[model samples]
Target: MQSILKQKIIGIDFSDYSIELLCIEKGFWKPKIYAYSRCILPPGVLFDGAIQYPAALSGILKKMMLSAVPNFMKNGLCVFSLPDSQVFFHEFIMPAALGGKSLRQAILHEVRTKFPMKFDDLYYDFIVSGKNHDTQNILFFAAPDYILEKYIQTLLDAGLTPIAIDVESMSIGRSLLNSRDRRKDVLIADIGSRYTNIIVYNNYEVSGIHIIKEGGEKSTNRISEQLCIPKAEAEVIKKQIGLSFHGQESEVSEIVADDMKEIIREIKKIIQYYLHRKKITIDTIVLTGGCVLSPGVQKFFQSHFWQEVEVRNPFDKLRVQKNDEKNKRNVLFSNVIGLALRGLHTYPHLRGVNLLQKARSHS
Candidate 1:
């Protein structure tokens, strides 16, 4: 049987504020980007990870897919990501003696007991890493059934096949971590328009994830309120000035500083929790998502964290076209590129957890 990992697929990321789509040709050494595009979502289309207007979203997606890639309709296989707020993650260790059906049963029982929601209302999946003596370490995710169905139905309405679904954190991890960095402990802070997703990766597997309800949108709103300007104008100024703390932008930067500090504090808490539980220090911190486009944000993180903090570019390894404008906005596509990388299967360690088969099995 042909492995699904080897198949060519498009990757889609649905955020509260925007939708990103990427299609790439999987190569042996590096993946080549064929096309990519981003579409801003109108307000009320998606809120807190739920699709409030499925038909409207589908219509927008249909237009985006048609315009972004020439052969999107013919090659409809796609893997998509759900927002971090809609997904729940947990890690546990089960007896290595359990195998196959027994392991599945054990995991299901544990998931049902540990998670507050009933199994019937949720779709869950897991990946087992290596064993430590007699116990196998496992990372699993559960998302509400209604949300999953909404995504699947939206894709269907857009004339695309939804092959698999994953969370944003996994996609970010795949896009940011290279082979050398996979085995090292790392922290990823993905600051999007409406949410900041903090993910911890230990020894090539996701160990922890947390979603902060603050992000670039909050910063923009602060800038707007402080400058007494319209939001659209504030957005432009925010990107142009961006926490530089100098000259004309200093006042705007100061206004957004509080939110940034809160985000950093949350990151610290997540790191401390991981360190206390695992006894391993995080080797590096990778920052991605739209907020990373802020002019001095990377330096801000580096100064505060006192660790090797770097902004992630999902397209760094891919072949670049001459004067490609999309390359400059790599941070915006990090999650979608990571989802596309999941399709390439160049790095098995970075492949995301696909819940499609698990969802079907439950049905």
Candidate 2:
């Protein structure tokens, strides 16, 4: 008998204190989510994006799988994300004369020499973002192989399989571009627990990506430490009060304002750099992930940057069942949703990289 084909794709979002899983099967346009699970990490299990308690995480994953998806379990390929801090992204210009085979060879050679770590020590990918008069601009991304291997092992220990590894920023970009028009340049900002990632796409290709060392969790930590309150309570206040409150003066508000200033400063620098390099103003700033949900976050950008900033809804143009409306509104699940949507044709060029790897292995 012919072996059963595995078409389902799973996405795991291992955040600071929670592990989220979104499993989906390809439909006509968007993916149909088959299973979704979120497990909060035990106290002291993980802190500030570091794995302080691997055993706890593994236990959580195992229990979640048993409870969430029982019958279809198989190793089950999953698309995993790497923290913004653990990865490096750079864009460089390639000689315009190097086209086709020559261009491919040059990129492979450069990846080996320019990377701080040995080629085998890191998983690297490159995207060509069109050519200038004498050079072709390319975006290069590298992440430690060991870090990714550990995540893969974590899944394995929990009886799951990791099939693809992607940068969180790119995954967010995938979801945004998939729902919106692809003909325009866009920027996607993924606000995670402790860090925010910015990815700029020109013509649907990654042109630039950067990570800033601030996010919702930082705001919560600052408030908790300054006010001497519990973390849970601080988080609640941060999300509820947000940055727009006009009453109740305290040190926590000052700290939050400082953090916002730093975040906005870096964002302006990155946006300016993109404008200079691309010679085109960004069409839209799409915010996703957990942090952007806070009240006035969109207003913060609008008042400061003078650009049209819109919160990204992964299901904005997609269809889902009536029961899934609430789940569909969670922007924090955008990366996982996009990862699952990889099974669709929305990201065909990304698939080309896998084929290129195969050809290299044969050669």
Candidate 3:
């Protein structure tokens, strides 16, 4: 493995609606943010976590690099994240007697049997959490081979070195939770433009991840339909009066409230599964991503769930350079920031889930 202690890494996240990039320098005590940028992706370029137009997307990435920071393509090591909806996650136990090649074979065999899809069609990885009496608990992650290849080829075409690829759930948990927070079981809800990712962390480890096909775009569309206004105008209205239930645009609030209730309903299903399976009760819920910027969204979640709810700020521990007002408060970059932190080895506990690690080793 390469030493990330003193390296500068560009972390990129590709969502259905936008692409986010962040450059950071890893310092001994703290990480320093160099520059960050977000570009709205053209429709049909990406859909349901699949790249429909690789060439067009790569062209946009090349332009984004040149515009964000001059000479950033030179020796720029990059890490990117996969959308949660496209990835598969499962937790299982394997006999501890298996070790070395035996353990590897056992895991592969189990995955082949338990995974719904064929093993040849996927790139899968696992993290062994720990050993219990006679078994080892493992968390598995897998993504489609074509999807991973498209992203890798896109980065290579843009003249960037791809170091690692991760999923949004792990990145969200790593960036939002502090050391103390990790010690306790918590739930993280990341509401992006097109999907909402719910992650359950037990004893500071990822236990479950679920993705719903609803997000900020759904709420905006609801507003647009209800008021017969343009999407742009509806988006503005949604942000200004989101689920507060008080204002002249209370109708907009009602629309957002309905969408939020659906999101919370899915979240509760995941919570219920965890509680029934592991007997773990999550006491805190951390909200992050672009949709969380809506007004009163946090309060709505707090009221709906008994757990303490709070919005995530990725710059809480890092020293942010002097920047404009917009960059300082941009919560949408949480996933990218987490990718950079992981690339920099900032959080030891959240390491080694990179999908590209095995490929790099074989190469």
Q: Against the true structure, whose lDDT is highest? A: 1
Give Cα distance to truth, residue 181, candidate 2, Å.
3.6
Worst 10 residues of 2 by lDDT: 354-363
Tens-digit lDDT track of model 1 for 1-363:
154555567788887788888888856777787766679899999898899999999999888877785344334678898887888888779987877777878888887687677877777777775567788877778888898998899888888887778778888887888887866888999887778998888887777778888888887887888779999999898888788999876887876677788899989888888788778689899998877887888888888886699886778767766477877888887888888877666543234577665632211
Give residue 326's error in model 2 in angstroms.
Answer: 3.8
Identify the runs in model 3 with alpha carbons over 4 angstroms from their true place: 1-7, 69-75, 321-329, 346-350, 358-363
Q: Give Cα distance to truth, residue 273, candidate 2, Å.
A: 1.3
Sorting all predicted structures by TM-score, with the top scorer first, yields 1, 3, 2
Q: Estimated TM-score per prediction? A: 0.91, 0.85, 0.90
Clashing pairs in 2: none
Q: In candidate 2, how many Å is residue 217 off?
A: 3.2
Local distance difference test, each candidate: 0.79, 0.68, 0.78
lDDT of 1 at 190: 88
lDDT of 1 at 214: 81
Model 1 ranges with Cα > 4 A deviation: 1-7, 69-75, 346-351, 359-363
Predicted structure 1: lDDT? 0.79
